[model samples]
Structure formats: C-alpha cells, structure tokens
Target: MLFQIEDIITKMQDDKTGGVPIRTVKSFLSKIPSVVTGTDIVQWLMKNLSIEDPVEAIHLGSLIAAQGYIFPISDHVLTMKDDGTFYRFQAPYFWPSNCWEPENTDYAIYLCKRTMQNKARLELADYEAENLARLQRAFARKWEFIFMQAEAQVKIDRKKDKTERKILDSQERAFWDVHRPVPGCVNTTEMDIRKCRRLKNPQRVKKSVYGVTEESQSQSPVHIPSQPIRKTTKEDIRKQITFLNAQIDRHCLKMSKVAESLIAYTEQYVEYDPLITPAEPSNPWISDDVTLWDTEMSKEPSQQRVKRWGFSFDEVLKDQVGRDQFLRFLESEFSSENLRFWLAVQDLKKQPLQDVAKRVEEIWQEFLAPGAPSAINLDSHSYEITSQNVKDGGRYTFEDAQEHIYKLMKSDSYARFLRSNAYQDLLLAKKKRGPHAYTHTSCLRACVKKAQSQVNQQDDKCLELHLRKGDQGEYQPCVCLGIQGWSKSSKGKSLAGKRLTGLMQSS
Candidate 1:
C-alpha cells in the first residue's frame, strides 16, 4: 500500500505541490542564511553580539564590509555586505547572506583557491554545475599561486617551530599551518573542523552507541556557562538610577571645585581690568607701607600657572548674565529644574514625601529629564500626572514616588540611565548567568568559590568577613556599606567557627 501511494504521489505531484524533489537536507540548510547589506550586516551584528560590546564586533566585521564573502569566520558561516562596499559604521559580522547577491564574491573564491594551492588542500562544497565549474577553475588558479608563496613561509615556520617546540611542547604548530584565508596564503580551519565534526548523525545510528563504550561514557559534556542575566526590568532601572545619582554627586563636586581653581589661575594671567578680583568678601588690608602693597600687586606670580580647567562662578543669578557664565555652563549641563528638585529635598535629613514629589514635578515642567514625575520621554507611554506639585511635606510617600520613577524608567525604551554601561553590564550579566550568553551555572559557582578563597586587599585586619561570594548564582558582587561591622569582627577564631556552622547548615 505504501509503495502504491508513493508511486501515485510521485507521478501526480505538480511542480509546486504533492511532493518536493529529493534533495539532501544540506541543500535547504545552505539556502537559509540570506546575504545582507553592509548596513544591515552591521545592524544584525549589533543585535546578535552583546550590545555592550558593539564596537568590539565591528572590528572583526569590517573585513566583510571591505570584501564580501572573501573571509569566512568558518566554512559554515559566510559574511557579505550588500553591493560589496566597505562602509564606515557598518558592522560586518552576523549578517544574513541572501540580501546580498553573491556574484563576484571573490573572497570566497580566493579562499577556495588558497586552499587548493596549499599542501594542506581542502574540498570545496559543490554548487550549481556551470558556476561550480567556473569557480573550481578560478579556485585552482589562485590555489596554485597561494601554494607557491606558502612553500617559503612553511619552511620558515617549520624551522622556527623546531627550535621552539622543545620549550613549548605543543603539537599545534607542527600539525597545521594557520594563516588567514586570503589569496596566496596557506590556511587551515582546524578549530572549525573540530566543531563541524563534533557530533554524530543520530538518524544513522539505530541505538545509543555512545553509551556502549566506557570512553564515550567518560566524555560527559561539561557545559561552559554564558552570562545568565538576559533581560532588564523596572527593578534594574531603579538600581541603575541609584548608581547614576551617586555618580552625579561625585561629578558635580569635582566639577565645582575645578571650576573655582581655574578661575583663580585665569585672573592672574589674563588681565581682567583689575575688576575681576580673585579675592571676594575681603576686608582689604592697609599695608604700613603703601609701596609694599603696590610692589606685591606688580610682580606676577613666581611660577607660570596654566588655568585651562574651566571658568569660575561665585554665585549664579538668572538675571545677572556676565558674572554667572560658569553657573550658566553648569546649569546648561545640569538644568536649573534639576537643581530646583535637588534643592527642594537636599538639605533636610527628612522631608515630607508629598512636598518632595511636588518639587520634582515643578522641575519636570521646566526640563525633560528621565524618571521625573512630569517627565514626558518620547519613548514613554503617556500617563496623566496629578495637578498638585510635589511639596516639602506633600501627600505622596517617598516609596510611592520611587515606584513611580521606576515605572517611568521601565516604560521608556531610550532611558539613558538604564542603558549606561554600568547598569546594562549588571542587567545582561544577570541575564546570561555571567558576562557571556553561553555562561552556565557551574562556571559561576566556580567563580564564587574562587572569589571566596581570595584575600580582600582593602583591610589588614580580619580576612574572613572580607571574603565575598558572588551571589550563589549570577548576581554581581558589590561591597555593601553594611559589610563594615561584619568585616571588622572577622579576625576572631569564633567567627571561623560560626562560618563553619553556617556552611554546614547551608549544605
């Protein structure tokens, strides 16, 4: 019955229906990756690799942009930029191959030639009959040239290897000639060969042949862990903003101090009409000798001082334009509205939550900073704000405001604070289990154990308390302010005993 149906199916099938021609699965697989344009290649590469390391991927990708399909990362993977133009800002890696027309793909042809020319020859994958014939001939011509050039290089490498192999005891250099797959180069893809041949075809094997042997059983796969943390959420944004605020404080203080120092240095070098006095709020001392005061002012400072830091401002009044240039710069960088918001809540050790909320809203009205109550980020979903502004002792609670800010951050795709390296690192590291996508739990566990064994160089006192473990799984290590007390007391033998007991209980 099966034979009869098969016979009818084959005979009656239209070109488009009933049954497809019997071609190997490899044929379909080969067609899957589409050619991509240089721009599309870059965009796809950016998406595929870690966004945090976009620039790193671009370094390798640019080669494909320069020469389409000339260099393959591996035999299974091909890269090409559309129109075969090397472009600035194009990421050449991980592009779909079909979007590009694969005509003139000299890079791939060059590689084929280089392979055939070398003593270490490789098989070329056959394609269409006519094209394949042309490619094979082209490949043979290049291959001959590559092998001739490589003969000289091979002799040099072998001589060098013979001298160094005694010290290194590595068989790698002796086994294969590792060269870039460029025309006229001896090249090999040993790592890729291992990868391509790593697994057996399960369909051909009727039973668990791997389990039958002790050697096979011993070769249990030990997975390498990728970064565990993959996605970021509102909680992650809050953590990011908390870190940003700390950075803002540090940056602002440093900026203000530098601004003042620069102003003092500038007034001495550039004549400021004697009106821009370095000394302000001074009771001018009357020297016993008027000549002494005159002499002190006349002689320039003992050393040449370079005042390149920035301008200075003693005070900034919105109405006073000239004196407040420095303040204006600061205001431009960190808006006046943000200043108002900070001023509203900064001084008091405690403030009414409602009042704080109102002040933040007022600031939001003046400026469009991320995570503000009235913040209208282009990326954010619009939500109505209450009419009442945040006041010093207003009705909304601090926790409520914090949650609102967090929600605002989550809704906006382009929120700067969330995308900052520090936050994204933390977020992605959490998603991938560690820093890379392939990171697994065991690698992380090993890292935790290793970190626990290491000494904390921060203190000369107790070491045990200073021992920090990466979160039992993938959370990043951060020194908590609360660790001081525990770290301070870890020197005692009693602490070691407690640690042992805790470990036992945990186990």
Candidate 2:
C-alpha cells in the first residue's frame, strides 16, 4: 500500500497544474527550498483521488507523510496539515521501498553529528537527547570509533553549500522520523511479523504458468545433479521401522506417566470433589441452603476446608485463612520475603498504567536490588534478566523473578508449611459449632412446643422446671411465666399474659 501511494505521490510531484505547487519560501533570514504547502497537497489529493471530503484528503496526505514520502521541514513530527504548513518531498534513497533498516550505530552517529553542529535547528529533542545518552552508555566500548565517524561526517557536511546542507539535513532527519518517530507518532517502518518471516524464507516461484519445462524456454546446456540420488535399501527401511518402534514406545511411556499423574491427583482430591462425594452441608447450587458457602467463609474454618489446603500450594495461597497461616509460618522461618515478592509482582500486574512504572521500581528496590531491605534469593540467570528489565520499569519487569520465587516457595516453603505444627493444629482442631448446630430460632420453637405439652397436662411444676434452671439462667424467666398464662383462670391468665408481653418487649 505504501509503495503504491508513493507512486501516486511521484506522479503528483511531476504534474504541473493538477499537482502540488512546489517552490522556495523566503523566511525572515533564510530560504526554505523545494517545499510545497500542505493545502496544495490536500487539494491535489482530493482532485485526483476522487475524494469529496477535505478531511479525508488531509488524512491521506498525513498517512503519506508518515510513511516518509513527505515531511514537515521544521518539525520532528511527520504529519500533514491542511493549512500553509510547509512540507518537502523526502529523497528517493531514504524511502521505505529501499528496505532501509537503520541500526543503533547509525542512529548514534547521526545524533552525535547533530550535537557537533552549533546550529539551533539541529538541536535534539528531549527524547532524542535521552536516547543518545543511553546509546553512549550501551556502546561505551566503541565510543572513540563512533566519535571519529561523527566528526568525519560533520566535516564533509560543512563543505557542502549552505542551501544544499539544509536540504540534506532535513532529509536525514525525516528518515529517522520515519524509523524512530516522535514518541506519539506511528512508526510506519515497523514491518508485520508474518511479512518479516516470509522475507526470511521466501518460497520459490514457478517461472512458467503453463507448466513448460525450463530447458524448452531457453536452450541451455543440461547440468548434472550436485549430489547423486541413491535408492532406498533394506537397511534404511529396517532403521526407519526401528525408529518408529522407539517413538511408539516413548509415546506409550509418556501416556502411562500422564495417566498415573491424573489418577494420583484424583485420589488426593476425591473426598473434596462435590460430584464424587456429597457436600457435607449440601451444595448451594443443588439445594437452596447456603450452609456450605457459610462454612467455607467462616473465621475459624472447618476441618474439611483446612484439609483442602494440604492438597496443593496453590490451594493454600488461594484461601485467605490458609494464606495468612502460611505467611506466619514463613515469618517464623525468616523467609517471608519470597512470598512478599511474589505477591508484589502479582499486584504490579493489576496496577493502573500510570502507576505501573512507580510500582515496578518499588518492587525492584524492595526485593530484587543489591542490599534490598528484604531481598529474596534468585538464580543468576533470573537475576540478570530482572536487572536488565528493571531499567524499563514495566509491569512485567519481575515476571521471571516472580516465577522463580513461586517455584521456590512451592517446592520448599509450601511443603514445610503443610508439615508445620501451626497448619497441622488447624487441620486437627475440632470445630466448636458445626453447620447443623441448633440456631436461636430453632431452640425457641422447641421450647414453645415443650411448654404447650406441659400446659395441656396441667403440670405447672414440670413446665417451670423445664423453662427455668433457677439462677443458672438456662432459659429466660419471661418465657417460663408466659407458659403459666395458659394453665391459670381466665382473669389470672389475662393478667399473666399482659405481664409476660411487657417483659418480652423490654428484653
């Protein structure tokens, strides 16, 4: 698409009347040469491309400018404006059609040359200056060589005519503008990964569409094959058969191992599986009762819930109570930094984009840097990768380090935690109240029925004895007296009922 658009732009440049009017513009002190107004470019695009909307034409012009076909003469930003903004055609040599893959060395030399020039127009932008500093540190070993090359280029550039130098400098800047564009500008030079792979390993094209032989097309001398093709022998066939047999055996062994792992996992968790074993307090989905969920969320978890933590390290970390217990265990062993670093990395992934860099730096300083307050042990490879990634301060800067710490905790600390007395005691501790324990509403209903049975039998002693345990406060005195109302005379019963009602309301 870019190449085709560049062809159209070339035609537009060549046309005299229906094309962009190119001319030199005299500024306050100097002449801006071979530049066209952005308005002229937009008008030409709308006329030739049959585009009705001026905005569309301007957008097309911007796309062409972004691809380095044209650029603003005075700005690092490669964009087209539908006003009097001056844009100059980029040199054909620097066009993306040439597959210009500029390297860091070339970029460094260009930046260095800009620094040598005392012209105000050649001053680097803030981002460019920062990039130059970083490149210098990266290529410190070859700094002398790079400096010499930049000095040589600057000397040659000075020899050119002033107008010619201005054109050349702007063209070179535009090339970099397309490659390492301004921070927000789109980098048009970035190729698709699929296209890059195709370029690496291109498929052969058939020369003749009609399937004609190459020898018939042009009478050339026939050449012998580079290497002699040999027929397959019995030994080769037998070797292939043996290789196939070995592959089958290996596949079978892998299948057996997978089956064994699945069986072991199923056995370990079968008791906790709601489908295999009925839920202790009934599954909420199957029954309307939410006793199972309530039990799981309780401050003092049930034995079954605690037992699930022992099934895997992930399970232990997943449960709040279990994770707190594990953290305590880690603190006792003075290795809580591993879990802390792991959790910090997890949290870093969820941070807002604006806060990600700050949080990344905090995590690195707290757990990964040299002499860090709570440094966790990391292998040399992970440490090196993390150290390099910390410079960017991205969200995933600690991915490798986090993975290493997680594995360390799972293999060492998690196993030890499960075996620790703290965890074992929790798993063995009997729950004071089970899910089916009597609630206050249920107890109240049972007491009411017992009192009614005693009242019908006219056994006041039995009713009082059952309702109140005298000073022990087994039941409320109001409830005990409330039942006496049913056994007394009509007047006594009315007085008793009023008294009980008052007591009940106050209580």
Candidate 3:
C-alpha cells in the first residue's frame, strides 16, 4: 500500500509528460474499491504489529499529522485527532481549532515547504522510535531465553541425587514441557550469544517477519480433511504422554550439559589461591585453659557508660567497674600486670610529696624492677628512663612510666580483653538488659515531691515524707527525714501540691 502511494506521488512529481494534477490523483485513489480506512490501519497496527493501547493510537495519529497525510472526510478518518485535539489537514487546506475547515490557502509553495520540513522531522523521529522498539523487543527475547534455560536447570536440580526429590511432580513436568525449546529453536545456547557468537541471535526469534519456529507453527493437532474433529482416544493420550516425556528428557540433557560445561569452565579458569602472611607464635604465658574470674567491683556497673567509653586510660578511670572487668579479662590472658602498673602509676601521680617516694619505689619493685617477679615487658630505654624517674621523684612523676604501661595494655591486653569470653558475656548481658532496664521516672516523682514538701522551717513537728508513685499511677506516702537545703520550700510546695492534687483528682 505504501509503495502504491509512493508510485502515485512519484508520477505527480514528474515534469517530462506534465505532472499529474491533484484532482486526477484524488480520482485515481477514489477509484480503488478498497480505500484504507482509519479502522483498517489501526487494526493492522494493533493486531499485526502488536502496537495497541490508547497512547500508541495517539502517537500514530501525531506521526500521521506531522508527516502531512491527508485524511479523507469520513467517520473513521475524522476521529484521528492530535493529542492537543487540533484538527490537521493537507497543505493549503486549513482546519482551525473548532475542527471546521476554513479557506484554502493561495500560497501553495509556502505550505509545501512547511509540510516538507515537518515530514523530515517526523520521519527521523519515527525511524528512531521503530529502532528503539525493536531493540527493546530484542532485549526482552534475550532475557526470555535465559530464563527458560534457568528454569530447565531448576528441573534438573530437582531430579539430582535422589535425596532432594528424585522425580519432578506431574504439574512441574507439564510446565517444563511447555517451555522446552523445540529442535530447531534449541540451536541457541545461553553461552553462544553471550560470547558474542551470533549462532542463533534472539533478534531473529523476536521478529515475526523471520517466521516462528517449527514447533510453534505445528503444535496444533492436525485435522483429517474427510473427518470432523476426532475426540481424543486412548492412543492419542499415550502419544501425548510419550511426547511430553521425550521433551522432558531433552530439557534435562540440555541443562545437564550446560551445568557440566559451566563446572569445567570454572575449574579451568577460576583460581582460589590467595596471598597469606604467616601467623605470629602464641605467647607461652597466655594459655587458653586459664580460668576466668567472676569478681564484682564496689561500684554498680553503668552499661551506658561502658558502651560509650573508649578503650583508653581516662575511660577506665571514669568507670571503675568496667575497668575491673577489663582487668579480670587481662588476668585470664596472663597480662594483668600491665593494668596493675598503670593503676599504681595513676595512684602515685596524686600521692602527697611525702608518700610519693615510697609508693614509686614499691611500684618499681613490683613491675619495673629488672628480674622483678611481676615484671611487665618494656623496651630497655623505657625501663631505664622509668627507673631514673622513680628514683628522682620529678615533676609529673611516673607520667612517662604510666604512658609506657598504658600503651602496653592498649596494644596487647586491651585488644585481647575485648575479644575475651568474659567481655562477650558482659556485652550479651547488657544487650539483654535493654535501654529501659535502668530507667526511672524521677521527673514526675520529683514534681510531686516538691509540691508536697514545701512546709515552713518553723514547723519542727511537721512530718517529713518521701513519696513514690507506684506502677498504677497512685502515690504512696512514707515518712522520711528531709535532706537539708531542699530547693522547694513550704510556700511553693503548698501551692503546687494543692493545684496538682486538684488536677490529678479531676483527671
């Protein structure tokens, strides 16, 4: 039909025999018994080319208008409107916004130039759109083939080892049988195209013009010319089951080959060797069999503070209980002397001038002395400097010695302590306690207490009370001596208590 139209257009352009007039061209088109209606074009576009839906219809209409196609005055042709609802027409024939034709233009050359330019733009857009759609369809078919291959492999997996369901169920077999590629179609393996070998390109599969595979074309049951459609007999059912079984076998073979090839490729090309450094020898003193201590410190443990604290000397000083826990862990590693030396140095730092000399001497003997029973490992220079500092009792006494011990613990003992079973158990226990475990609603209680405790100082006989709100939101009263300098006094407490009591009672 396009060739026929182009042939007519070419004859109209010829000048040697005098070009065919517009009216003669119109007469020639009209003489054709089967004039292409909008419905026929739309149906061909949607059903044959698979371009359906309202949006596609609008796109086709816009392309036609831009390409300057003249729509004959008919019910079908008139319905084709631009997305903006404008009625378009051929050159020199104007249709205004109201969908009614105005006057024809006398300036035909100007109209011809405008229409040609619009056609050129629209042709480029149309070509790009067609290519893009074809590419999308190609990609869709490619993934479809991959998915089918994967599904076949899944069927093979189900039948492997005889332990994980040795046989496919009836429904599963039926599903795989339907998707199994026929002999001619099975020419393309996933690796073939993936390796950029165009052995069986998916583009050929997606394009209808290339023709469908033999199985798709021949799947329908044949009809005898002389007989009405024969009802399925026992023989036919047996044949179908046999065909399905054969298909299943073919699929299994295909997938098994693919799996074996993949395994072979992986074995041949993939290497698991990695560069690794030799591990350091384990310390003789740090035995894994050493027992852990369950010692509790004097201070109540603050789980929050422990979590927030860093692995530093200042953090250990701030949380005595966590520090104690860390020390116990280090004891299990046979490295507790590091912490002991650090703590001794810390204590010596604040010791009075009179006590500093004796305390420093004791610390040196215990942890810094050469051949000392509980001596901590340190560099020769550090050991000598520490010994000199202890004897001199200088400014920031034991400061350098403390830093040396701090680093020793931080590098070795502190790191080991964090990974120890004791520290892990502590972390587990804290996690079990959760955020609300240590929580108290002190603000509400303090508010009520302040409101009630504002009695005058002159009233010595007045009862001092401690109030607590139970879980039921009811206040319980108990007698207790008031602490000195309670901020809320008699005047404010009395006023606040009365207002709060009224509000609470009303609520």
TM-scores, in order shown? 0.14, 0.41, 0.28
lDDT-wise, the better of 1 and 3 is 3
Q: Which pairs of residues collide in model 3?
A: 454-489, 454-490, 455-490
Off by over 4 Å in 2: 15-18, 198-507
* Per-residue C-alpha lDDT of model 2 across residues 1-507, encoded as one tens digit per residue: 867988887888885645777899998987889999999888888888899999899898888888898999889898889999998998887777665555567778889889888889999999998898777766655666777878988898899999899999999999898888989878887667677556642222213322234333321122111111356578767856676666566634578899999999999889788889986767778766665677777787767778788788899878888878888899999999888888888889778768999998888889877899999999999999889878867666787788899999999999899889998777666332223332245565686676555544433343342233222233432334334443334454545444444544454
Cα displacement (angstroms), candidate 3, residue 475, comes to 16
Candidate 1, 227-314: lDDT as tens digits: 1133657876785667666656663457888999888777644643334543211223632223234324532211111111112211
Clashes of each: 43, 0, 3
| Per-residue lDDT of model 3, residues 1-507, tens digit only | 334433433443345644422221134423211123444344434553467585686566444432233243221222344222222123221211112211111111112222233233212233333433343333332433433433544455556653222112221221211122122322111233344443423222211111223232223222111111356688777867776666666634578899998887565434321223221111223633111111122254435445534435466555677777877777877878878887777777567657877887788788877778788887777767766666666324556667777777777666676677776777676564343221124534675565345533434345454343433354544333332123243355544344334433443
| Model 2 local distance difference test score | 0.74
Worst 10 residues of 1 by lDDT: 301-310
What lDDT score goes with residue 425 in model 3?
Answer: 73
Error of 3 at 119 (Å): 99
**Order of models, best lDDT first:** 2, 3, 1
* lDDT (Cα, 0-100) at 360 in candidate 2: 89
